[model samples]
Target: MRVRVATTILGITAALLAVPACSTDTAPPARTEKPAEAARQAAPLSSATLETRLLDESDLGEGYLRKPERPSQHNDVTVIGCPSLSELGGDAATGGTLSFPRNAKADFTYGGSSSEVSEELYSDNAAKLSHGIDRIFDATTSCPTYQVLAGGTPIDMASQELPAPRGLGDEQWSQLLTFSTGDRSTVVKQTAIRDGSLLLIVSGSPALVDRHLDKALAKATTTS
Candidate 1:
């Protein structure tokens, strides 16, 4: 049961897209006049290829693209959901999904999410994807329990259960997180997979967002 939904961003600030390299000061030794060695060194290992493409309104999958009435500078965001695949992009056979965005040279902004739950408990297995906007959530947040998997391998699960005196209702679990990271404030909703797990991803610049990690926990009373 995989379903997709869309969200809006008031004003978006594209995060830093460049991945941080290791902080190493060691330099390579000077090359000798060896013809064979010089030729091998000159040969490129990897080609200068484009990495990402921006998703525009016209470029999104049918019925998956949406634009707010009041348009803004960072208004281009296309989201998709597939339970069997990462929301980002990679191949299914080799765990990868591809997105042919608008242009090759453009710095694209995107997020990834996936979740699984027991059919007996949850109505639909749903996932959410949002772009062009950061999550908005309060400083004090409550995350729901979710299953975790690494490369299709079952890892663990995560939960948010309080003492009997203070417990949240099921409806509250669907509420979004109100938080501000750097120049953006974001709110992300939690989707529980009755006896399954979910993955919410975030990527961009520090000025926009930071770590994109999955929160997992194991429950004491497992669902059938």
Candidate 2:
């Protein structure tokens, strides 16, 4: 049984977003290339371009069906327990100094059942993108357990760190989140991969995320 979150942030953040980079830097190469690579990465992508790169029903194959896009809108959510998450009260989907200039999103459900997978793309400068990813992961981890007030009703939420998938991106973060209302609880996994100026987040059923993460990254980076 799925415990759907009542709040916008919980719904979007849960179905919508997830985040880090480890400090295992190897020594820099003896030879360095021109700064062209830096400029290229800093370049922003347009929303249309982003949409083309997102996974479609075709890319996902046989039984997967794309879910309709949610309209562009925001209903603020209030966070009561975690100071780090307090910032989320204003805009949970996307906002603030490190704002992504362009974004594209797509959602899918597998086999006609409740199993789902969603992907989001954010484009900007590498530095800003990296910071944005960090912000999400940091806030979630700031409090292992927290409370949110949505629609005048208080909901209990929990965030637990999971080993992120490696060797797929420059840096990544993974977490298992639980949203509870009374005895019913909804569990979801979010894995975020940050490569250069692009940040890709794949979240939903744990199995679905793992099954298509590599595919999502490959398609997102390739030109149409």
Candidate 3:
């Protein structure tokens, strides 16, 4: 179900091209304490190196295929606002349509007819990345149910906050969203983790996403 949810969401990537990247608003300040000295010492992943380490179809298990037509990189941060359950990384970055400063980003998707996985990398400081997570937690908590129009159709959606997974990053958040229209339904499991200056988001089947996240963080840790 989460894979199907991610697939539906990835289908709307083209729609994001129309959203203007003009928002100058930054995320609201977080109430948490500053990062520890050790956290600050961790290295950031460069765009080039991140691309090399990103998960491809091979890493997504057998029979999972990638789209050759998809762009290798996406620079416009504002396009994260599109309404799709699998767009968890985008939703986290923009704080549910609230834009924030992001210096660089890269995303890739692998899918089959019934399942999909989406991974997104965002480059920013620990504070900014943490703030973005806070915003998403706040939004999901305050308003569990909401609607966003995608391609002029109202999509009914609901979110449920889950306990944060440990040992993934400096800070992490997880949630589940169910999207419905008439009888069709899709459920997505999303996880956002802040590893030093990089923010990694993976959405789809929880098990697959979790597995890939561990691999990603491990590669990120070794990035020079």
Candidate 4:
């Protein structure tokens, strides 16, 4: 079974912390229920936002897709304005583990997992993840996926055969795609989940979707 993958955009750095205590070869499908209240309680700083910047390898840290600018405070919710996946080399999968600078105090770190899958399977799985998101989110791109949540309401999701790159190979790397929801007035995000790791790229600027190089990499530690 596939799980619908839900990621946090820059606006608020929040993800449901459902501990994967078991190392099951098969991950159960994602639950449709909203994220826990604990995540919602994090509360976002309305004024806090991410500045648009390049998503080049130079921009990446240890292995993370960093926000253009750091949030005002540690764990502060920062919105990634707009992004261009191509700038980050579009799914080539860089080698090495990625980590945020200690000074940045960013709450999450993603990328560089010991697990992997072939490009053929990765591409096929991306399609399933895409279809699952379409069932949950209002708008999204065909390849790389992105979604926006309204009023801090977290959307539950799942995916199957999510791929994790093992250092820039033929594996069709998944990326975050920007999109909007609701009245289309507020909230936008980008998402990329394969294998077990997921990346949520976000931005909020009312109908200003672009390919301009903006990205956020939120890493969740997964077991199994």
Which is the leading candidate under TM-score?
Answer: 2
lDDT scores in order? 0.21, 0.66, 0.52, 0.24
Q: List the residue pairs that clash in candidate 2.
A: none
The alpha-carbon deviation from the true structure for residue 127 of candidate 3, after best TM-score superposition, in angstroms, is: 1.0
Stretches off by above 4 angstroms in model 1 are: 1-172, 195-224
Q: lDDT by residue for model 4 over 102-220, one digit each (tens)?
A: 11123222353211111001112323433333332222222243232334543322222212323211111222222233322222322333322122222222121122212223112
Q: lDDT tens digits, residues 1-224, model 1?
A: 22121222211122221222111121321211222222221111111121111233234223322222233232222221223212322222121111112102222233221211110111112211111101221101122322222223321222222111112111111222223333443333232211111112222222222121111111111222
lDDT of 2: 0.66
Off by over 4 Å in 2: 1-42, 87-99
Q: Where is model 2 poorest over a 10-residue stretch in terms of lDDT?
A: 17-26
Tally clashes: model 4: 21
Clashing pairs in 3: none
| Candidate 2, 1-224: lDDT as tens digits | 12222244224344432211111222321212223343446467788888888999888899998988776554445566677665544443234433465989888878775577888898888767766666767777667888765555565877776776756656677777766767656667777877767878887777777788999999888755
Give me the displacement of residue 99 in model 1, in angstroms.
26
User: Could you estimate the TM-score for every candidate?
Assistant: 0.17, 0.77, 0.65, 0.20
**How are the candidates ranked when ordered by TM-score, highest leading?**
2, 3, 4, 1
Off by over 4 Å in 4: 1-10, 13-72, 75-185, 191-202, 211-224
Candidate 3 residue lDDT tens string, 24-79: 22233232333453157344556666666666766656766664545433323222
Candidates sorted by lDDT, best first: 2, 3, 4, 1
